[model samples]
Target: MGGRFGSPLFGASIKGFLNDRSALEGITSFGSFGIGITGLYEYHLYLPGVPGLRPFLGGGAHVATGRASAYNPYADSQFSDIYAGLDGVTGVEYVFEDIPLALSIDVLPVLNFPGRIGLWWNAGVSVRYVFK
Candidate 1:
């Protein structure tokens, strides 16, 4: 009865910081900011006989939004717009037996219209709790 569990789990995280498209495009004339949230289902992918460490993978969709602004001295005004998009994520995680914690890194590639396709990555420490 210890192979893989069939249930749903919930978790949350805060990102340290993010790199904006303006920097990637080499456009210093504009300023931008971005943040994201995600929900996913976990599926075990390791051998059941293993005891110390376990590895798993997850897939989900996330919605992110950002704002960009550009200044124009000739027009005597600043141009700004807010944009949002949805992205897909897939990554692996590792859980240690000695502690009730897990660590993972995921690559989230998004398709944004009126903009360019870019990849956003997130890596952080996480804690896992079992509920029955």
Candidate 2:
């Protein structure tokens, strides 16, 4: 679910997470999973032409689906009914001068829409090889 798109300015990825109900809750017996995709643009930040730490800003979209059931004092359920959201990201990347390999870390703020309005932050790290 991760790979570079042959360009330093642009990259794409898809990711997912899973959790078991026993781990999530002490009573319920259901599992859940979520998936999302993102595209990023890395701006060539200024540092006297240094290619070590290039900071960038970009945005993309995401879609996630999952549900968890609760059964302790009463029966209840929660779902990521939002389904989709817009993502804003800011990050810094470093490319090895002798090779086409790059590594980066980013923080993303998400805005979910429609009936399930919510905001959250996501942070990640990525490594890529430019095929230029």
Candidate 3:
């Protein structure tokens, strides 16, 4: 019951983001690279006898930052914008003891200041390392 079920977790990941609005007009695209780091606490909730899958929930904070540059032909100006946001995440994960790794994907909509609603999507993989 305590093999891969009892431990504190930590990980880092790189993601691509599609900002709804940017400095340019008629052009909204996903990021080339948006990197982030995370720290999390996970707890197992399923019974020991369950052979199917183990479910767990985690909560954590993530930081993402990126820069965008675009050329506006009409305005004849090059605009560069830097974007950064902090997000709070809560999601479920599935652990399969048959394999040595656990895979998880979570929707971490963020609250970014200086923007409307500031809801951004963040989803990625988390490699788990269990400790006794």
Top of the candidates by TM-score: 2
- Candidate 2 lDDT over 14-76, as tens digits, reads 322122111100001112333344443333454567856667666767554444333111112
The lDDT values for all models are 0.35, 0.48, 0.37
In model 1, where do residues sit more than 4 Å from their true spots? 1-32, 69-86, 113-132
Clashing pairs in model 3? none
Name the candidate that leads on lDDT: 2
Error of 3 at 130 (Å): 5.9
Q: Which TM-score value belongs to model 3?
A: 0.46
Tens digit of per-residue lDDT, candidate 3, span 1-132: 111111111234322112311111010123343333443444445556765344444444444333332211111123333334445554445556666444555545454443323555555445453321
Question: What clash count goes with each model?
Answer: 0, 0, 0
Query: Over all chains combined, what TM-score does candidate 2 have?
Result: 0.61
